[model samples]
Target chain A: MRESRSDRIFYMVNNIFLFIILIIVLYPMIYIVSCSFSNPRSVTSGAVWLWPVEPTLLGYKTIFENKDILTGYTNSAYYTICGTTLAVILTVLAAYPLSRKDYALRNPIMLIFTFTMFFGGGLIPTYLLMSNLGLINTRAVMIIPGALSVYNVIVTRTYFQSTIPIELLEASQIDGCSDFTFFRKVALPLSKAIIAVIALFYAVGYWNSYFSALIYLHDREKYPLQLFLREILIQNTIDAEALSKGQMSIEDMAARQSLFELLKYSLIIVASIPVLCIYPFIQKYFVKGVMIGSLKG
Target chain B: MPDNKTYFYIKKWIDKNWQLTLMVILPLSFIILFHYVPMYGIQIAFKNYRAVDGIWGSKWVGFDHFIKFFKSYQFIRVTRNTIMLSLYSLIAGFPVPIILAIALNCCKNIKFKKTVQLVTYAPHFISVVVLMGMVIQILSPKYGLLNNLIKALGGEEVLFMAEGRYFRSIYVWSGIWQNMGFSAIIYISALSSVDPTLHEAAIVDGASRLKRVFYIDIPCIVPTIVILLILNLGSIMNVGFEKVLLLQNPTNTEYSEVISTLIYKQGLASAMPQYSYSTAIGIFNSLVNFFLIVGVNTIARKLGETSLW
Candidate 1:
């Protein structure tokens, strides 16, 4: 309970340490942003300042000039929007039915869903199932298989059960409101916080998805921006022998490698900025949602 | 009562709605088909699988793949590296968010706190591929900021990505950097729910910030810590394979060949497609994870506290 002089010094030092951590966290992102706006030569030569040295829009220009990059962005935007809408709608529908206390089958149905959170058939079965469903390579593949997340359903159902008081529902029933009417007017209106959080989660999941597209999507035309950026960054960092027994000449290889290295950091910023800009509004809700969802049953 | 009649009427209505029934039916099928069905293929580890012959037709070869894996030269190295890296991440990465949340809680400067939270949370949404690319750019021996900093500090440059010894440290620490802030948000939310009256009382008693954090803040969140730790332990086998796969080269393969990557190489990356072998390895991995979760849950139950059940 006592604050000695050393304790005061410790508190000051801790604040300073927290400040240093803040810088460590922010520096990479700031560096990437700066490099994206810098001239290519400055970026390639690693002579760019913490702020852009030349302050040019050339990097952005170069990225936009590539037709594949533009298509990739469009495809990613398309999938994220379509996918999040379907996912959220399906999740709410499924969760609402399961949240009913008097639903005779609620316990078994909930168990069936919860069982999946622990176990799975791993990747192979999932892949086979997708193919058999004839969903492979279609835009539908991006949305359908992931249309309902069990975890998201549980969170929504919990929110409905715990936060939406039974007394409110009873009052609505006394007012002669139908089940759908109560859900549409009262429940959904009260659920904006959880909905916002879940929507962000689903949006981020859809946006940052590369692994699913890697397996299910065969056509490059359908690749998301993350996959496009992935190929540019990691795919280009391969050994020559590993590629095709030295097809590339020394000079060409060197030039290609240089572009790959220079573009890597810039690409991170380009891919991340849209999602990053939206974070501040959703930031407060994310923690509350995750804690309530995670720490509770 | 009218309530009893209403309840019966609602139940009757639900029974007749086939469309609603199909909602449960369709999604339930997805889980069963995708998640439960392939569990049958786990037996392939004890069999010699033939694609044309199928799972039933595959010849039983009891313990053969397991023996082969155990005796294989890469086995000990991969297992040891995987366990060690996971354990290290658990030790170092788990508590970072807890500490960070506490630090954020102690800060009275709301502006400074929010700025720090925003900065820290940014890295989480950055994909593993991009994060690794950033890591390589910043740790490259020739031009990296870290190496340059070391040079400025009168130390030799370290090839962080190339050296096996440094690989786990880089992986774990970078992991902490990416996730600690995002993970802390939950704990911070939990901290907020702690009765402010407790903090006020401690302040009146002249409790130092460190004392308040250690005695009051941490204890308030111990249940959260325990639940998260148990869940974490449940999925220890799932090391983030994509990051490791992206970062690894032949030079660093010794330290980088975790289970998922191993499954990937066997399944899709081999000279010959060994789907059966990969499936076997994957099954082995899942079984271990299953046992680990069950074991921890049992212990939690025995300890007379929260269990997943």
Candidate 2:
């Protein structure tokens, strides 16, 4: 690997370009975190740049003081845990049989599953259906409608076809193991990598999802963190009525407004921690998940 | 005698495979209840749906709801907004990941490469609402970091979020920034799997690093790019509604009012919801997307291109 002068220049240039991209991507996120920790006055005054100025726990303290924010957190966690379980279970049940080489209805059933992806009932009809089923305003709505993802089924089926050997199934069958028993005993255990990947995928989706809850949930208490955050961020504190609910005077109103700004930054950090904290651990599996998903079986 | 013979075959199959069938029953029924039944429920678009009458029992109005949507002023606005935003995002956002993946592939420094990847990928997991919150916080004209910088630099502060003209670019570019690393994973893996022999052979022919990248790396990933493009085309009508809805204000609604948001608004946001009309508009949107996907897929298959199907 003899390097020419031009090759050296090329390497230098490439590194510089990549370095710029790294800064561009990292700065805003770093800035946001810094702002979250900064004194609220410094945050409002724009004195904080790359690092926190007059760092304090006020933003986090304020976030915890609000009962609404805590409820949002607990609700999102419940949905993530319950929804991921149901999603993974349904994906396995749908995918495993279809992955079997001996299954006569595999392709047709796959077609049915995949067809739903391209064409659907769309938003309005789906809403109507949810209401009709008594899922609207209920906890069941978030977990139920998203239980069986066709994409997850396909990904899991692909994993099964590639990883779980057909001969192993036959070997088990010779010992009087039925399909259900074999899946329960052999397949699920062997497929932990794919399951972990899929579970993380589903869990991340459940954690971040607010659109379903937005449409179905009318109860303020059932609102996911994202949806509730949407109201705080988008609605802003411009509504004097919402502000006055705290019984603030005109002077205290100004304080509430600035506090809300600090609250937004803190709330964003709080909301992101659950998914982002566990992300690194499962990230390698999900990278494998993406790799598997990209290739068709 | 034939019936008896058929029954015997059916019984044999069922006895051997009943467990598998039983396992799929609940999941299959779930799909039926949610996906298939909503599809069946789409017929409300053709009826004057009444709460008392239900979906099927309602008086059939044929294409009245459809005709009403076709004539409405909002129809043209939403369709245009949807297509423009989709194409804007697709054309602008599609290429960066390939470029990013290629550049990262060239970097010999694994530490820098991994750090860059981790940082860029973090935003993809940020919920749409929080991302929008960040957007507002950073772009707020009065106190935002962006506008404050502009003011310090002796330039007029621009309210990026509040302006209609900046809506599409803001949405699309922010989307690219958020999803670039996450999306590049596939392409990066594709580049990794490229044969080293070809690069060696090219270098032997006096190919520079850039030349090798052009000749070897790009050619290897074209099939992947094509398949991804086809998939993108398949779902081009679905500009993610969540972000648009979050970002939309009264001032920006002109540019931001897409089919999905419109449907959500018309169906749910109004005082007296236009249920049938909204459903009709939704079906029309889905049908167009369905046909576009089929058309693109057929063309790809016919041309011997690696298609999504």
Candidate 3:
């Protein structure tokens, strides 16, 4: 292929643009981490640095000292663990039957799930149902309502259907292995990629989720870290700073506003670190799995 | 005798399969209880709901809430804002990812390609609340980087969030920024499946790289694009409740108060809950999305040989 001069120039230009974009996307996160440990005063004064100046652990100390913050972390961890486990189990089991080529109910069941995706009863009925089921203000509300995501189920099913040959199942059946035994022994072992992808998706959704918790959980202890962070993040900076600092004059507050803003960024860096650390291992599978799941009819 | 034998065999199968049933039972029950049953609660949309009266016991109003919502001064404004924001997003926000995917696809440097993908996808995982916080700070009039750059260029700092006109642009564009990389993954995958032979043929025909991309690569991903478009059109009214709620202020409420926010306020925020009204609006929102999905799917199937269904 004869590559033209313009093509080379175009490639160079795009490369430069991509690098700039990379910096833009990465700098806020890097800046947030640096600012979190920097001297509170310097952070307040809008000092920009790639590295922390007069590095201090005060923000971490302060956050750790707060009982509400600790509770929020516990709640979030608990929900993520329990919700992800339940979701993965349900998703796998549901996906298994539907993945069967001879399953008479597969298409209709999938359509039923997809129907819920597009049309839902929405907030009012969902709330009513939760209250009626005695799940309101309970941890069950956080986990049960979102146990099976139709998209994840479809992804898992597609993976199984595509990867697991029907001959394997037929061979197992010839040995007098029952349907359940065949699935547990043969199909389940071969589904690690899809399972891992679905598990990560479920975990991330549970970790980042707040809407369900917001509607169902009334107790402060039940509030997840994201919801608690939401409460802090939504507050007006001057007022929040004043409240935290035990009251200050409105005139004196303007200077401290920048500090509060920095703290907000700092909190983001703090909260996002756990998931960000785990992302590289899973990123390779996510795009492939999502494409297969979404592109299917 | 044959029927009895079949029945006996079916009973035997159930007995033998009870363990698999155990694996599915709890989750299936949860789905039915939480997801499917609440769907019946759409009735409240037509009723004057009272907590004491409950759903069925509540007096039937028969589209009265819809009429009231339609007549309210805020109705047209919110609907317009939602539709326009989503439409802008659909037109502008939708194609940027396709372009980004192509750009990433064409890049020859492997290390740089991975770096770009990593950087872009990171923002998608950042919680909406946190993302909105970053937006507010970065757009702050006092020390915001955006304003600082503007001042450096001798331009005045503008309150991007407070103003009504800038809200939609910022909302839609910011959404594109947060999601562009993550959402483009699907399209990029589709691009990978494009037949290299076609590109080779185009090159032999004296087509330039850009022209080859236009003639070959873009054509291959058309079905993926069309399907994504229909899927996006289905959710045009959603407008993402969390980011809007977090970023909205009193000054911008005129333009930013969307249907979801209105429902949130009425259902949960209000001391005297108007469950019926919120229920009506929720049903109405779903119906709009449903019709959109149906309409777009039908049109795409007719025009492009692709549909979400």
| Candidate number of the best DockQ | 2
Question: In candidate 2, what are the lDDT values of residues B160-267, reduced to their tens digit?
Answer: 987899999989988998999889998998998899999888889988888888889999999989888888988888988989998899999999999999988988
Docking outcome class, model 3: medium
What residue pairs are clashing in model 1?
none
- Where does model 2 sit among the CAPRI classes? medium
- Candidate 2 clashes between residue pairs 3 or more apart in a chain or in different chains: none
For model 3, which pairs clash?
none
**Error at B149, model 2, angstroms:** 1.1
TM per candidate comes to 0.89, 0.95, 0.92
The model with the greatest lDDT is 2
2 or 3, greater by DockQ: 2
TM-score leaderboard ranking: 2, 3, 1
Candidate 3 deviant stretches above 4 angstroms: A49-54, A237-259, A295-297, B1-26
Q: List where candidate 2 sits over 4 angstroms from the true fold.
A: A238-254, B1-8
For candidate 3, the per-residue lDDT at A160 reads 81
